[model samples]
Target: MSSRRRLGARWRRHRPLRTRLAVAASAAVALVAVGVCTAAFFVIRYELYHQLDLNLTQSATLVIQQHRGEAPGVLAGECRFQSAPACAQVVPADPAKDPGKGYLLPVSPPVRQVAVGARNGYFTNITLPSGEPARMFTQRIGLQDKSLQVALRSDAVRKGVGQAAGLLSGVGAAGVLLAAALGYWVSRTGLAPVARLTATAEHIAATRDPSHRIELPPGPPDKEDEVTRLAASFNTMLGELEQSVTAQRRLVADASHELRTPLTALRTNAELLARADRLTPAQRDRASAALGRQIREVSVLVNDLIDLARDEEPTPLLEEVRLAPLLAHTVDTARTHWPATPFELDLSDASATLPGVPARLARLISNLLDNAAKFSPAGAPVEVVLLAGELTVRDHGPGIAPADLPHVFDRFYRAEQARALPGSGLGLAMARQIARAHGADLTAHQAPGGGALFRLTLPSEGGPG
Candidate 1:
């Protein structure tokens, strides 16, 4: 089949809601209409035939009564003609003796039984000798060997019933059509809100903007329907989408700004290396070291950006994290890198096991230690203390300015005095992200020793801090 034809067939198999509802309404109305119409037609036919039977029975009785006072065999003559009240038959009566009189219709064997007093009189359908349909009534003349039968033409009765049937059929057809039309109209009226919802969804898809919302009719909540709840849910989803898009745009802009300095330095180092043949031995070595340092800075910034990108999710797969042992190993590694800065640890009651991603917890602790060591003066002590689930890292270096405290954990934020430092600004941001992921909190303030102090408060195994 052609594509369009196949699609049409599929749609027919699963027709729309309105179509099915309309069809159901129409079917119900049709069933009722059919029953009523059939009953009415049969009733009308019965009434028409009943009048014809009464006419035949009455005409026959009146004729028999009129001849009662006469001689026994002297039957009425007018009933023998077609123009009389009814065509009649009188058995055993020869019109030859009563010359110039119209001949009467002959009676059958069943009517002869009435003449012999063998059977009761009854009515029956018959045909006249003139090829006309009729109804006949037969009965015996009292105490005589003769019977009287009367008939009336039935063409008018049949014609009346036919006319009534035609009228009822027309009414039934019109009722069915009207019912189908009304059913469709009612369905359309009820589904108006669904139509509007479909249009709004299509508009959003075409424009790629989630800023628009569905408006609702003003009413009490008790009167509200499922469609109203659906509209509210759709509006909420749009709000979330807009916020996510805004955050993504801001991240991209901030990352570009932070990357500019290192990229420029790398470009300059590349140019210098292109002319390495003209530089002195010491100068070439220094240039090579500078180049490697710039590369390392760029790599660290990229890695930190990746870590912050996963900031929206909580820690995965909660596992027992031995805080004290993880801390000891990380600090030992930090001492190797920052040999000029002495480290002191006071881990008296810090051996508590917490539920978290072990690797993420290690990264959070590392960011804190690295930040403290980088800001401290040469050979100054970076004191690390942990008791229970709280940790404090105090450094004897220039403390953060009060004005910059609130923005310290913001991505790409740098203090005025710290802009000369050789580190990416995402360190504190990544630390805050991981802390939040593990249901903990990290904050920075001035220590009593006139240095920057970073404090981390961790939650219990399954609870928030």
Candidate 2:
């Protein structure tokens, strides 16, 4: 039994979803139909038998009233021998008083009991002498120990019940057919969106193009269905992927353009070093220094490119970062990098913490400080502060131009005035990327006093309220 059930379950699992749905609908209807038919069959059968019994009871009563004062022998004289569906007979209270058994209905013990008043009157099924089905009613008359009995044919009742069964069978079969059809139609209509989605996915897979989009299924804007949600999510993923690919292409193109000047300078300086004997000692020293500076420039550019690109990729994990010590440490490093420009450090709320990758956050802080220090005049202070879960870095150079404020954090963007400086344009852009990845926002504006101010705002999830 268990093995059979397992096999059935596996078969059902393997069946096509539409077929399973249709079959289930059909099976449910079949069960209901069978139940209704079975109940109706029994009810019709009972009612048919009941009608026949009513008629038999009426006849018996009439017979008892008609022969109320007569002797048992007088009623027995009217008996019909071999009556096809009906006959009458009597049994006296005393067995000897009954007519001979040869020409009368058989006297059962119950019939004898009715004659003697030992049992109440009742109806029962029997067969007449002619071999036809019948119902019998037996009752006692008021006369002493005298009783009346009647029998009626019941073949018509059986025929009526048989007709009802046939009618119900036909109706049940029609209902099952309708149920199966409706199930199939419903499954087909409901799965239409899924079918279209499958086809669209296959097209995307074959073509390797995310430019294609699925049109939204028709529905009210406020009522979002499952398929609609899934399609929307897929479209969103495609948009992000397209943007990432575009950004990568832009990064590569910009990197190549940026590398050209340093590469040419490095090649030219190397050629000069190759002809070392042709030049004097002082000139040779100058060439070597120029070569070293070009090498450092190329190195810094490459590192910045790598950092900017890596920032766009998702960080898989993070740890809680204590902003106080991290800010202090990056500030010290920036002061060393720009020793000529003094830095003013303030850690007001020293215990502020937020969820972030520690190393990335440190790099972000360093980039902001370095950018500020690069723009500050010698001996001018670059003010740094960490208070109330926010960090601000302000420089004391000429404040940012109104036009340059918006593009400061854009990749490879350098204002005309700042083009002569010795730094890649990726520092601020990379800083912003890291800030957003850690659920923080980085924005730049002209400082009220002078120079650029970069503010880093942390999310409230982990930072101090």
Candidate 3:
């Protein structure tokens, strides 16, 4: 049983959708046709037999009425050896007086038994001595001493029923064939969209092109079908895939370009250190420090590249986090990292909360603070403000150039003024990515007091935790 079920399942799966649909429709139509045809054939056969039985009964009645005044034995004598359209027979009720002569249809024991037992006329089916089918009616004739039997041949009825049944069978077969052909046409028409979808998917797969998309046929806007929905979903998925591929390519190209300068500086520094005896102690110390700084720079750049590359990672765990405490912590950490640049905090008393991943939010705050501190002049204060779910960081330094303001958040984008800064340009880019992931926005502009201001805004209402 299990093996048979498995085989059926395999057959269904391997079968084409159009073929399956056609077969299913055809089978349903055939079943209904067979049932209706079979019922009609049986009804026709019953009606034919009923009509034949009525005619035989009427003939028997007519013969009795015609000989109403005759003696019981005289009626038997009249039918003796007579060949009529319908066969007739008579038997004497009195056994001793019975002539025992044969007539057109000889009375059998079964017919006599029926006549003896019956109070009135009764009909039955029988086969005559000649091996032909007939219907017989038996009853008493003029008196109690005699009985009569009348029979009609049923060969014609049988032939008519047989022909009708054959005709019904032929019609049923024709109907089934027509139903199958119609089902095939309907299935092909209905599944045309699916066929097109399959072809497009195969082409994309073979060519390894994520840019390929399915175009929907023009139809009524209100008539949204499964095929249309599926095509739309496929196109959306392809668009996302294309964007991801483009981002990946851009990351590789940018990383390669960014690594060249530090790598070259490291090589130069290493050569100078290799000639230790030819250099002064101060020069050797400087060379070693420069090499170490270059290594740290390269390490930071590599780490930033990895962080940016993981664009498809699952979203980090989010929880309702209080902005005040997290921002304070980030500022304290930034102060430890950049002791020369003082950070002044101006936080609101109102507690601001939002749904966010704690670590990512912290990283975003740290990057904004670090960016401000890096551009600020020595001994200048970097102001940090948190109010009404919005955080603003301002640095007292030369503001960003107007042309560079738009692309400050772009990956690996360093403006002409800040190109000499010792940091990978991925900080602002990663900050913006994290902000977007947490359903917030980050923007940069010139501050009121001739410095750059970066503002981070969070939704006033919390999102899913």
RMSD in Å for model 3: 5.3
Q: Could you give candidate 1's per-residue lDDT for residues 1-465 as a string of tens digits?
A: 699999978877899878977888888887788778889999998887787777767776777777653432325434322334577646533333323443455456776688778888888877666766676778777777566777777777778789888998988898899889888986787666676677778988999887877777789978878877777777798889878777677778989988998899999988998899999989889889999999998998998888777655365687878788998998998999899999999897676777788887888889888989989999899999888778888999989888999999988888997889877788889988888877788999988859999998888654433
lDDT of 2 by residue, 1-465 (tens): 999999999989998776777677767877787788778888988988877777776666666656566655424433232242235655577877865544344567887788778999888877666676667778887657856667776666667878998998887778777777777876677666666677778987998776777777777856977867887787788788778878888889889999998999999989999999999999999999999999988998898888787756356576778899988888888877888989999999898898777887888898888788777889999999888878999998877888888888888988887899877788889888888878788998888867888889888776322
Ranking by lDDT: 3, 1, 2
Clashing pairs in 3: none
On TM-score, the stronger of 2 and 3 is 3
Worst lDDT 10-window in candidate 2: 77-86
Candidate 3 per-residue C-alpha lDDT over 1-465 given as tens digits, one digit per residue, 9 for 90 to 100: 999999989999999999999999888888888888899899999998888777767767777776664443324322211123356656655456555454455565654554465466677777777778777777776545456777777878888899999999998998899889888987897778788788888998899888887878788857868878888788899899899888788888989889998999999999989999999999999999999988998998897888888762236676788888988899999999999999999888348887878888899999999999999999999999987778999999999989999999988899898888777799999998888877788999999969999998886566632
Best-fitting candidate, scored by TM-score: 3
TM-score of each: 0.59, 0.74, 0.75
lDDT of each: 0.79, 0.78, 0.80
- Return the top candidate by lDDT: 3
